[model samples]
Target: MKEAAKGLVPASSSVNEGAAPLVERLIAAATELRIGVERLENGVTVLDGGIAVCGSVAAGIAIGEICMGGLGRVRLTTSGGAGAAEGGWPTWLEVASAQPVLACLASQYAGWSLSASKEEGGGKKFFSLGSGPARALAAREALFDELRYRDHAASGVLVLEVDRMPPPVVVDKVLRDCELAPEQLTLILTPTSSLAGSTQVVARVLEVALHKAHELGFPLADVIDGDARAPLPAPSPDAGVAMGRTNDAILYGGQVHLTVAGGDEAARDLARRLPSSNSRDYGRSFADVFRDYDYDFYRIDPALFAPAEVWVSSLESGRTWHAGGIDMALLRRLWLDEA
Candidate 1:
């Protein structure tokens, strides 16, 4: 998609190497972060954020940073005034990245689909969209071909949002594809129904915006910087409910600001087209949409995968364009406990 920009822009850093230390740091603070760390017999390190242990918001924040390949910032903040009251959400995740294209699309986009079925020799079925720095090492997605970026590192980490540990065959696949020894690899699991998992998913607000812009035919190289915020939803016990809340947090309440180097008209058009509201399937909760579609994500509209609102600022024109609006009433109805 960004074939032209591939030749024009060079990757500024190795995502794997940048995030390796962050992974170590997260491990070092695991106890305090309320996460579980285990080493497999073959020496692969596994960090469990929510599957077997109680994972906290702090762990999610650290994992979110690692998912960006250490090129982005993810932190918690709070909103104020009537809007916060109406939305019934006060706490939010504030995300920012100076290297928007690389930090988001190249590392945090969850483009690598990894799976191991029972027929594939794993006793149980396993499937997940792998995210984080390990994706750079694998470079399995065609998106990497368009970006023309690869990472060379002695160690790598992958973050998977799953309830169960990956099968041995799946682990072996990652080791082989990433060209890393068992001892040099780490796998972090964050289930969607857990606190840490929900937080980390909501932290992808800015990355989602960047991805949608690319889908909309915006020049990725032109996007210089980006920042976004989305409410931190209460994790639900039901897997479907949890997934819906995380997605709706961004689709209904998320806001994004992108700094681009382009003409004012281009920026304005991007602003007009970048919100989830523009989708034909926009008004309903994502859970309801997912249910109506028989739980198949591919059947849903791709255009609906965007923030609630957006602002695009043209660096050359010194003017900003804005579009869309947040649906706090819908968010409140879905998220609030009126009892």
Candidate 2:
């Protein structure tokens, strides 16, 4: 698996034209090794016919290594989408199994697997299993194969949705069946509004149970909470939350405050003046700005509220930029006095 690099250069720096030299270097290296390359729109470069080299490198190098050698044709694609595209390598398998009626209902809606097996008391049990997106596709294919074996219609199957996190005992069983480690498992919780109310409730319960299991050292990678239209909560802890503009000013220190007036354009101009030239386009949400503000001195709209102020009495050499708060008095003394 290859991890993408961050902090390569300032986002506003146009000198490089968004192309890193390393990409060409890797391409040359691959060509030297006799690997083929296929290019796609949106910066997707796939190496045809090779095993992916597992290591860390610049984004360009990582793609090149994947094109080098492998059991089957291994392709690497990169996008800014949530979660790793293709669910990252060394894939983890996700399974969803439920009562037959429920499974049949879900299958009708989502085209997941639904099958019936006799239970001890004479009722039927329904189940389905899936991996990440690619594996899910594979699972559907396998289901069709199985359906063909049994001479049954396989249209409109629903993937299984679990309500409560599985108990450790149940999780262990699933791990054994999938032959996957706990770290690979990512429990997905569908919100109550999207699914039938009953199903939604169950999903929430399962999510909580799985969270406890994770806290207890289960190897689960994450428990995804899902709601079709719900806004994501702010990141935990003040330091982690991204700042964003509500109207005139940006919110920070748990309150909306005025850092700059005028409007969004002015706020953005102030943002460009900040030392972190890599900050996202000011038109982007405050959360995005916060993510890039590693050295601080962030710009905000002052009309929202009183600006939080910090004093830097003197400049320190080699300090790069400053954090904490800005000194308004000094700013007025320097800029206003000059005016």
What's the lDDT for all of these models? Answer: 0.89, 0.24
Predicted candidate 2 versus true structure: per-residue lDDT over 111-213, tens digit per residue: 3333334452135443334211112212344332422211111111111233222234433443344344444322222211221211222212112222222
Tens-digit lDDT track of model 1 for 1-339: 234333423565888888988998999999999899999999999999999899999999999999998999999887622357664578889999988888898888888899998877456778999999899899999988888898888899999999998888889999999999999999999999999999999999999999999899998878888999898889998999999999999998889999988678889999999999999999999999999999999999999999999999987878998898888889888988787
Model 2 stretches with alpha carbons more than 4 Å out: 1-162, 194-339
| Top model number, TM-score | 1
- Scored by lDDT, the top model is 1
RMSD for all candidates, in order, please.
Answer: 2.5, 23.7
TM-score attained by model 1:
0.95
TM per prediction: 0.95, 0.18
